[model samples]
Target: MFARWVQEILRSPLLRPGIRSGHRTSGIFVPVVRGSSAAGKIALLERGIILSSVAYLAFETYKWKKGQTVVHASIKVDDIIEQADYLYGSGETAKLYELLSQYKDSNDAELLWRLARAARDMALVSTTPQDEKKRLIYESFDSAKKALELNELCWAAHKWYSICLSNVGDYEGIKTKIGNAYIVKEHLERAKELNPKDATTIHIIGVWCYMFADLPWYQVKIASALFGTPPSATFEEALEYFLQAEEVDPNFYSKNLLFLGKTYLKLKNKSLALDWLTKAKDFPARTEEDIEAMVYVRYWYI
Candidate 1:
């Protein structure tokens, strides 16, 4: 109730795509100090920040809980969706691709389903080994696209296809990956156009830029001279992209809080990160796969 009131008071109509109007991420809430008096307010703020800082931890909680749910899945396909989500959410590109490859012989009708799943997976992993993941990504994407072409479900493919392409940017070595960078970028841009209001698309773009802006821990010596100059909108742009995404798809990730919190830490901003992480910690949808994402987001600067 209070959160909604604050959102009503502060929401900017112009903010793109849309701001997530929720109570803020749980992991981020630790740093908050909400109270009646000045001291209480200060205390609240601090605690909220701490809570927010644990977005990664919160994400883990969600992942753990989610894994438990998947365990109870009644069927193979349901179990596959659960498993697929875990891999995709955690950013395990190589493993995700391998999973798709395993299902290569899926019967014709199931092909699109598996491909769509893989495309969604591609949107999460780093760009380095994308060459490694590409075959599966393409196969899956083509499968979905073909199905969509035959039917009218093509719209659904837009977001996942875009994601599959956009996420390849995070792989280890990208200078020589043929049909790699361009392929993903094309789909991503297309997604933005097809469904500019979608949260998944925004999240996809945000993750791509944030991960790239951070770069490898060891590459500073060689690329700092050029990449060091920093792209004016790279990180901030990603955040902008993601914020809009949240407005469109609040419940999409179940890990959105963790993503936002980690990105804030990258910017050396304290308050926002806390707000997000704290929210993540309290998620009822926790999954074990989310731990992978939490591990990546929870750490400082690395």
Candidate 2:
């Protein structure tokens, strides 16, 4: 049946259009005369069949090789997430977000927390419109929330949730932001307690303390009145956390040095402030925040 089909296609009128073989005078291949014998037409059909078979096989082989290449290069979910984490560490938030956003609906707690962190970081340095920033922050919060729902004991999930909430707090009203700030502290403390060696969490706690400490007296009074003794820290308290974080992981983040500098200035130690800020200025810029911190250090120094 297959052979008959091939014969039919080869002998089809479309392919059999007087395909003359050679120039009679020069004996070179050219269309000069039509076939005059039955045998000649049969030979032409046979040659067409052979050529068609070769062409079909060649096409099929090409497609098979292409398919094999795709199969070999395909990545597993774990491998993809691992690569995304590397991108995240390098401060490539856009690439990290692009790689992990496809897993937003995933139930895996680890993946969710990573996605949340990526979204939060992306929003922090985002140059987009206010609405887009809000969207990214909310998305970060949502992903972190989902991760905690799946496994509340996961320290990274809690940490990422707190970080996302902090970002969300910026757009919220003063009362709400103050309340969220306390929650952020709570989660950071929990994260630190869960993993004492985690320098990032310790650094975040230091940053949290520094932010509240630097708040103006009037806002402090308002927050105290509203929340009934809101969480507050002095530059001294902030410095301790920052130093502890440094002890655990030296120079883990450029912002840590920047914050240390700012905290010292707040404490009325100008010389120490200048020293720390100088170090921050010299630190290699890894992220947008790092570059911003460098600019801040120079501006304050001048």
Candidate 3:
């Protein structure tokens, strides 16, 4: 029976490594950390014995009648955070809201916050060009503010609020909300200082830097000459950060080759720019239906 259990464990993929791949911990082992978990320890011991016996039975069943063998189901990405990757995009709200509304047994406030955010983004993208940007920013900011009303404490949603405020903060009275897009850097830094392991917070800091830093050296020099507050140009630095972000999660960004081509051109490397231009023409993120894409392809590339 013991040998059968070992054999069953050897045959089971779950017993080897999990979805994490490199850092896999077997679920069957229950570590005794301290004296606080009396019931837990007892339960662990009981489960260990039962599990081994079950494994033996499973192996025997596998040999005799495969239908009687027990198996553990694999966890899907959707199970952990429903449509989690879509959280980055503006189109995920309706589906998320429908799921949230149907989940009556849920007490998860974070889920509610995400649903609200998605709805707000939908409103932002659907508005007319004249009022769309500002209106969407306000709509999303208001949704995030409701997290507190929904009895939820969400620092992440608050961060999104700050992003929205920055995006549409060009008007006179509302300019104070985001004094400069650079303020987001400090906020994200604070979040990172508070939680060193928070990848999302770190990513946002990179984003803030990229947006503010890549505003064109000539334009910035001109602004500084006139406005007397020239922020140092860091396009190379911004590029580095964006590259890091892309490395962290390649699937998050829709193809953005056009920007890369333009960036290379801005740096005055026509050869590299032409190569990137060719690549950009094939990217799926070319939303603008202008000759700009092919023009670059022909002028510099051909």
Winner by lDDT: 2
Off by over 4 Å in 3: 1-109, 126-136, 145-155, 170-178, 188-231, 284-302
For 63-105, candidate 3 gives per-residue lDDT tens digits of 2245332323332223423332232222233444333333223
Deviation in Å, model 1, residue 83 alpha carbon = 18
In model 1, the number of clashes is: 70
Q: For residues 48-149, what per-residue lDDT tens digits would candidate 1 score against the true structure?
A: 445432332322332234333212222254444444444444434445444444444554334454555654444323332645456644555566555445
What is the model-wide C-alpha lDDT for candidate 1?
0.46
Query: What TM-score do all the candidates reach, one by one?
Result: 0.47, 0.71, 0.47
Root-mean-square deviation per candidate: 16.3, 27.2, 18.7
Which one is best on TM-score? 2
Worst lDDT run of 10 residues, candidate 3, spans 24-33
Q: How far is candidate 2 from the true structure (C-alpha RMSD, Å)?
A: 27.2
After TM-score superposition, the amount by which residue 81's alpha carbon in candidate 2 deviates from its true location, in angstroms, is 1.9
